[model samples]
Target chain A: MLKISGINASYGKIQVLKNVSLEVEEGSIVTILGANGAGKTTTMKSISGLLKPNSGKIEFLGEDVTGLRPDQLLRKGVALVPEGRQILAGMTVLENLEMGAYHRKDHDIASDLNKMMERFPILKEREKQLGGTLSGGQQQMLAIARAIMSKPKLLLLDEPSMGLAPLVVADIFKIIKEINESGTTVLLVEQNARQALKVSHSGYVLETGKIVAEGKSDELLNDSRIIEAYLGRKSS
Target chain B: MLIEQLINGLTLGSIYAIVALGFTLVFGVLGIINMAHGEIFMFGAFIGVMITSTLNAPLWVAFAGAIIITAIMGYMLERFALRPLRHKQGVSHLAPLISTIGVSILLENLSHHLFGAGNHPFRASFAEISFQIGSITVYLVQIVIFVISIVLMITLSFWLGKTKAGKALRATAENLETASLLGVDTKRTITMTVIIASAMGGIAGILVGMAFNSVTPQMGLSMGLKGLAIIILGGMGSVRGAMAGGLILGLAETFIVVYGDSGYRDAIAFLAIIIILLIRPQGLFGQKIST
Candidate 1:
């Protein structure tokens, strides 16, 4: 439902995303795997309207949405859970959730808030607690729940598992699968290649702002280069 | 005698408190200290006086007219003066700060032309009755100023804490980028913030004019400087800090004038700020400086 074609994004004169492009289907979880400084976040920023691309177009669900503001994209049912989980640290968990749906004029928001509280019980217990005071895992959960609170047709998650424990990472991936199964397409950016491939239907391997490889998740998992670059020692 | 001074100090302090909140609200959201905020206050007071003296209007009419006009001025200051500079690449924080200083000078001069830099009587023709409170007598005007300030404070707290529009404002203040991603129209939030904060300054202007029975284009000059001292003494970007700091400075000024000398009243705000910073550098209620 989302297509990015030859988008070039830059910070000043220095370009970060060089002719990068990717597609996210209507009901599939697409993962973009890359190491640090590989332009993964820049691509997401281009799509989500944080950074305007220097050239090319971004079509979301068939409308040309390039150059729109972040809030504008959100109003159109595209939500991004940015890197580092950028929670409003001084705000309460409930406020954070409410902010996730700031543009919605719908009356069902309270009911959706209740549904989120039910899904993430810790959120209910800590509803009034400041977001900065939450544990890393709990913060990640809040970030995801907050993004989904917008009821976006497409959710872009950037490194949700970064700095998380192994068990918590597994749980996050499980939650991603659950979210995808519930009908929201996810475009996930991660360095956790193994778990990402296992959870995704198809994936692209980005290297230094260029897409180096793209195929079925299982095929990319077995690709010798992907294994060497991302999978590391299979024996471990 | 003590009770009389305390109440008088409180009456004056509430005026300072409202002015300080005006400064703090802009600083909190935009992270830019609007030097022109003092002029907004001054302008509002002038408007109040003009309405009373020229229009022969009631107090409420002058009050509403001053707030609405100043609020528009606040919105224009953000939209026209600051937004363009804010978006420019490689623009340092100093750029916006310097521009506001320019706006301050311009507004002061404009007011000088409009009102001729002279004090005007405001509601002085109205008969004011003083009622006895124990050993102290309080003017009806003083009572009005204090009660209005308290009501304003309560309403402001409720709006900031409980309303969705207020939450959007706080969220933008906390994190601009994240707030945008969450569907907050940051441009609108920022504009509205300045409008509300400037209206606060307008409120202070009316009250001070009423208390002193006169208004001048130069009045905001000293009060503006006092606002800076109060925020520094209270804590930067804190509403409660502004209120508490204003009261302390007000009480200090009142006592100094009564017991020490009238000359020391103006210096009280700066002296208190310096002393407070020496003991607790973050002001009375500020968080530790973050990286």
Candidate 2:
């Protein structure tokens, strides 16, 4: 449902994303697996229009969406749960979720909010508490719930498992799978290759702004080279 | 006599609170100290004077005119002066602050050219009217100013706490990127912040003009400096802090006038702010701005 073609993005004098291209099919979780400085977050930012691409095109549902601002992309049903779970710190949990539905004109927001509360009960428990006061895992849940509150057609998740405990990571991954099964396409960027590939249908390996490998998730999971490089398997 | 001075202090404090509210609102939403804010307040006072003198309008008309005119100016200031500098390369985070100072200078010069440097007195009908309560005298204008300031502050707090747009604004203040990703039109939110803030300044300006019976091109500087002190004293972006800070500064000034040397009012008021800052650093109601 989303196509990024040959996009190059830079921050001032330093070029980060160099001729990167990827496609996310509808109804599938497509993850970009990469190490530190692999331009995964940059790709997400470029797609979300937080960063203007130096060159190339981004198409969302066959529409040219390159250079559109984050808010504009959000209105077009694209939402990003950014790295570090950038939840609005000073806002209450309920207010943060309300913010997710900021651009909506529908009256069913109250219902959707109730649904979100049911899905993430912790958020409901802390609905009145300031978002900054939440634990890291709770904040991640809050961020995901905040993203989903927009009722996004395409959800871009950048490092949802970052800084969370392993058990919480597993839980978050399970949630991501469930979110994908519910028919919202997900573009996940992660350093956790095993969990990311396990949850995703398709995956791409990125190294230093270049996508080096692209294949079905299971195939890449067993691919000897990928296993060695990403899954931390030492070749004997 | 003490009660009279207390009332006088509160009236002045209410005016400062109104102006400081404008400063804090902009700072909260944009994270920039809008130096032009005081100039906007000055513009409001001039607009009040112009509307009253030229149009022969009532106090309400002048209030409304000042708000409308300064609100538009605030929007323009954001759109032109502040927003463009936001995305420029190598632009220091301090650029917007400095640019606003330039805007302030430009505004002061423009008003100086338009209205001259002399203090323009606003001849409100209620300026001379007073009622005695026990031994204390209360001017009708002072009561009006205090009531209006309180009403505006309460209304603002209500809007911020209860309304959807208000929540969006608070969210924007908390995290602009996250708010945008959640589908908030952050540009519009910032614009709304400036409009509301500038309107607050305008109202304060009109009230100040009516209270002291004088409006001048440079009036905003002194009041604006006090406003800066108020926000710093209260906490940079805390609404409650600004309100309390305003009253504290006003009371400090008035008490100094009553109990201490009248000439030491400004000095002592500012000294209290410094002492508070040295002690708390974050102001009374402020949270440390998280990185």
Candidate 3:
């Protein structure tokens, strides 16, 4: 389990995440739903160690990991699929996946790589091709697959559904479900509230860098009023 | 005589190629122009000369000494100069480049103070040695420079493509954030890059210095400018492009000096770069990145 308590993060003078707190139980998908500039990405960045929280604590299975750099968090089995895909454009898809497993010293990397290939069949076909050449949907999948390659205990996905087709988004949510079922905990950030709630065990609505609502996914979904009240005009 | 000229041109090309490789390496990783790189090349030459003339060391010792010293210099420059500028909040993208320019100026003046801004004659034992290759005379020094240059280039190419460290470097070059997210210590990778690049530049100074039998504090100015042309002509971040571009510029300059005149020598690389950019803006081996 990962616990973040009242973390405030910023980019210079501009404060992004103000007193934001959230939790993710092991082996479950926890979704953070928010619109643009809601600090969803910042929250993910803070947890994944890309951006250090100015205040508060981030505990991974009960150890303080706040202020640790990205690479260090990766070694502690926390991996992040950052927003924008950010795939290595010049490198092959295979190499991107290889990069995911960089922190591991285990000898079974080849087997794990094969498992990733089997899980994401399209990636296997395009293994030799450069990542930039892939379609948006394929790139998102590759990004997710690449993160999984690290054998991470906790996977943080920021905006996995952004700029993706509805059908592709559905496929991605399905893959996230399968990934969770197989035992890796996922912390997902998305704007697609309906679909995000559909797959997630629990959900939190983030607005203006603070948590506005938190509950079981079904409770949040079944009560349209609660979703509408917190998510405002953005939730569908 | 034509064969002799071609060989001489190639030897010169090899030196240019080595110098450009250093530029390519740093540019590929940091995405910043290190103006100090040229001074590193000049210092390498001066170090080699000092090792040879002052200490009376062997040619190989001079080469090794230059590499080690320049590599350390590379580390210090990156650690002290570029790294701090990199992390400072809201710093302009041009900040790192400007810092390098400052460092270059400091290095040039420092070398001037120590080496007296005068050209020092290289003291290689093989300076007088040469052999006949069927109507062409090749000096021992030229062969050494060419062989060393080629070997270093090949080795560097191998290391960048096949090694894990090389892959980490390329990954960082492609996207620093993603590389770190995937567990690459990008900070260390950047430092390592400068060290390697500086060593290459330094050793190149020796090879070029040895070939010309001279060392000067201000030598980096022209050579660094040639390196910039080669980087542009080769494509901004492509190592292979730098190598190919350097050789092209070197050969062009050599043929001009042999067939035309030495006065027009320095202008050739830039002219070629301008022509190449007009034809193919991406340079010879650069990828077309959308701005």
User: How does candidate 2 score on lDDT?
Assistant: 0.90
Candidate 3 clashing pairs, residues 3+ apart or interchain = none
DockQ of each: 0.65, 0.68, 0.64
Model 3: per-residue Cα lDDT over B84-126, one tens digit each: 9886788999999999999999999999999897779998987
DockQ: the better of candidates 1 and 3: 1
* 1 versus 2: better DockQ goes to: 2
Candidate 1 residue pairs in backbone clash? none
Angstrom error of the Cα, residue B250, model 3: value is 0.7
DockQ of candidate 1 relative to the true structure = 0.65
Q: What's the lDDT for all of these models? A: 0.90, 0.90, 0.90
Name the weakest run of 10 consecutive residues (lDDT summed) in model 1 chain B: B282-291
TM-scores for all predictions: 0.97, 0.97, 0.96
Instruction: Estimate, for each residue in A1-236, the C-alpha lDDT of model 2 and write its tens digit.
Output: 89999999998988999899999999999989999998999999999988999999999999999999999999898999999999788878998888888888899999999999999999999999988899999999999998898889999999999998999999999999999999899999999889899889999998999889999999999998899889887432
Stretches of candidate 1 above 4 Å error? B124-127, B288-291
Least accurate 10 contiguous residues by lDDT in model 3 chain B = B282-291
Pairs of residues clashing in candidate 2: none
Q: B10 in model 1: Cα distance from truth in Å?
A: 1.5
